[model samples]
Target: MLNIKNLYASVQGNQILKGVSLAVNAGEVHAIMGPNGSGKSTLSRVVTGHPQYTVDGGVLEYDIGGQMTNIIGKEPDERAREGIFLAFQYPVEIPGVPASEFLRASYNAVGRHHGLEEMDPIDFDVFVREKMKVLEMDDKYLDRALNVDFSGGEKKRNEILQMAVLNPRLALLDETDSGLDIDSMKIVAHGVNTLRSKRNAMIVITHYQRLLNFIKPDFVHILYQGKIIKSGGPDLALKVEDKGYDWLIK
Candidate 1:
């Protein structure tokens, strides 16, 4: 559902992603693992059309109906409307906006894009609650300002909750396991696994294999020096876990 070809991107004039390429099809989960500053997070941000990163070369394409269309110039919102979702490493706090209010606004915006009718607050509350159930979240979260004073684990779970609500066709989870404990990671993984379907795909980026133990990606890739240097089955992550990147880097 998504294809990135030899993508070269830079931030603040310093190149980060150099000649990176990968293809992800529907129903497949791919895990990207690499050392720090190896362009793992850069790939996610570039794919999501982050304004700070400029794509200097190569094609960014997505299946926008049934055809692979180049999306390099598309705005971030345009990409989001096209079923591209990014779960941030650090979810920012919005002090005044209730989580429910924020979620409903996003849901309605995406719904409107697809010619669907917007749900009223009462109706949306019912819909969002069901999604919250998938994450085992309580109703109190709905009233709190988005991520305001939420614990690290709560913030991570909230990111997964947003993914459930948006139901994006291509989900890019950037270090979702960051700052999460084992139990919390399992809960977040459960919510992610529940959302897996034949109509959607996911690219999970992380620095460790423990997250893969819960999420269980079908494919594992080793990204190094701004490029994907190795690709294999789930065992690849195990190899990385057993032996550090230096073995592969050598």
Candidate 2:
């Protein structure tokens, strides 16, 4: 559903992603593993049309209604409306906005884009509660300011909750496993796995393989020096876990 070709990107005039390429089809889960500074997070930002990162060269395309269209110049909201979702490594806190209010606004915006009717607060509460169930979240989360004082695990689960509500066709999870304990990671992974379907795809970016153990990627890739240098099956992650990136880098 997504295809990238030799993408070259830079942030603040310093190049980060150099000649990186990958293709992800519908229903597939791909895990990207690399050490720090390997451009793992940069790839996700570039794909999501982050304003700070400029794409200097190559093509970035996505299947918009079954046709691969170049999305380099598209605005971030435009890309989001096209079913691209990014789960940030560090979810920002919105001090005054209730989480439910924020979620409903986003859900309604995406729904309106697809010619669907918006739900009233009462109706949306019912709708979002079901999604919250998938993440095992309580109703209290709805009243809190978005991530205002949430713990690391709570923030991560909230991100998955957003993903469930938006139901994006292409989900880019940037370091979802970061700052999460094993139990918390498992819970977050359960929420992610529940959302997996034939009509959607996920690109999981991380520095370790433990996250893969729960998410169970269909493919594993080693990203190094801003390029995907190795690709293999699930065993590739096992190898990385056993030997680390040093072996792959060498």
Candidate 3:
């Protein structure tokens, strides 16, 4: 489970997240929905230790393997190594590094954190290929530079590929459905739905209920002005889609 308390975070002197709090239990999928500039993305970055956003107040804690750790104080890499995974809204590109090499390095480093030995090169190749296949990615993608020239949907699929490989305790997805067409979205959603289990939890951050239509969440949360304004089951998403965000502002 994860616990966040009264989190006040800022970026470049502007307070983005003011008094945000939420909890996600294991095996539960919680969807965070909000209009742009509502600090939905900021909440994910602050929890995962993005340095650009300073945590001015409150605690971001994670209970991993039954140990409570305050992740706000940890570095981004350190937090990643500690079973917290963020499937970025926009995955960055590194032109020189091949996708396979980047994943191997990341997977090995994270594996070490769990006291697992690194995978041999051959083992890694097979492992990555299988996961990529689940994402419907071709083998040729492994040879390409990480996210280099990848389409928006491709980038999103690649993000889930990391989540599949890392198998972290907590997965934070920020607007993962953006730019993905329905077919591509289904592939990504199926990958996520298949991965849900008691040992892991997911927070799907999105603007619409379309993605939720594919992977049903245990709870739905509406975020407005950096705080959780309302929560309900799937019906909340239906109401939002029927009424749109216009009603919420009023």
lDDT of 3: 0.89
Candidate 2: list runs displaced more than 4 Å. none
TM-score of each: 0.98, 0.98, 0.97
Residue pairs with backbone overlap in model 2 = none
**lDDT by residue (tens digit), candidate 1, 1-250:** 9999999999999999899889999999999999999999899989989899999999889999899999987899889988999999999999999998899999999989999999999998998898888787877999999999999999999999999989999999999999998888999999999999999999999988999999989999999999999999999999999998998898
Tens digit of per-residue lDDT, candidate 2, span 111-180: 8999999989999899889888878787799999999999988999999999998999999999999999
RMSD, candidate 1, Å? 0.8
Root-mean-square deviation of every model: 0.8, 0.9, 1.1
lDDT: which is higher, 2 or 3?
2
lDDT per residue (tens digit) for residues 1-250 in model 3: 7898888999999998888888888889999998888899999999898879999998788996688778777888887887789999989989999999999999999988889999998999999888888889977999999999999999999999999988888999999999999999999998888788998899999999999999898888888887787888889888988998778766
Runs with alpha carbons beyond 4 Å of true place in candidate 1: none
Give the least accurate 10-residue stretch of model 1, judged by summed lDDT: 130-139
Worst 10 residues of 3 by lDDT: 64-73
- The TM-score between candidate 1 and the true structure equals 0.98
